[model samples]
Target: MDALEARVHRQLERMRELADRMAAVRVRETSADGVVTAVVDGNGALVDLELSDGVAELSPTDFEQTLVSTAASAARRAFAERGALVTGFNEEAAEDG
Candidate 1:
């Protein structure tokens, strides 16, 4: 490989490192009315979940599933947004370097 290519690759590696460092963060999310809450990692893994007592009182067969799904989706969305920020930070850093 040539010098320029090698340098670019190094820069990209740095960018990836930055992304990885920021990626393992845990994020918490909740439903619109704060009834359901979920914790997710930067990889969008659902690490923890919590339901309000009020929600438990409702007692619908599918309600729990639906709330969990909703919370997961919200966490995923938050992760994606954070990932985008990381990507942008990498790009800017690369440019500056």
Candidate 2:
């Protein structure tokens, strides 16, 4: 292949790799008491949630706060991970070009 075509192919491959990496990204966080766990994908969408038996012992307000805080933590982690991955990819791509 020509040099230009090879470069284009490499760029396309890098883009595909980035997409795969982002798709595989997930962040999980549990509450301090370990009563609630939240899982979020790279897009910050809640993919799973777990509630331990101990959660039932919490007051209504505490239960709500735990769930909300846990989910927010997970989402924040996912966003941070996604940002780092994208930033690294961009740096690599810039170096390559």
Q: Which number leads on lDDT? A: 2
lDDT by residue (tens digit), candidate 1, 1-97? 6988988887788768777767766777777666678887777778787877768665575567667776678677767877777778768776867
Q: Estimate, for each residue in 2-97, the C-alpha lDDT of model 2 and write its tens digit.
A: 998998999899899999999999999999999999999999899999999998799999999999999999999999998998999899989987
Off by over 4 Å in 2: none
Each model's lDDT = 0.74, 0.93
Residue range with the least summed lDDT across 10 consecutive positions in model 2: 1-10
Could you say which candidate leads in TM-score?
2
The lDDT, on a scale of 0 to 1, for candidate 2 is: 0.93
All candidates: CA RMSD in angstroms? 4.0, 1.1
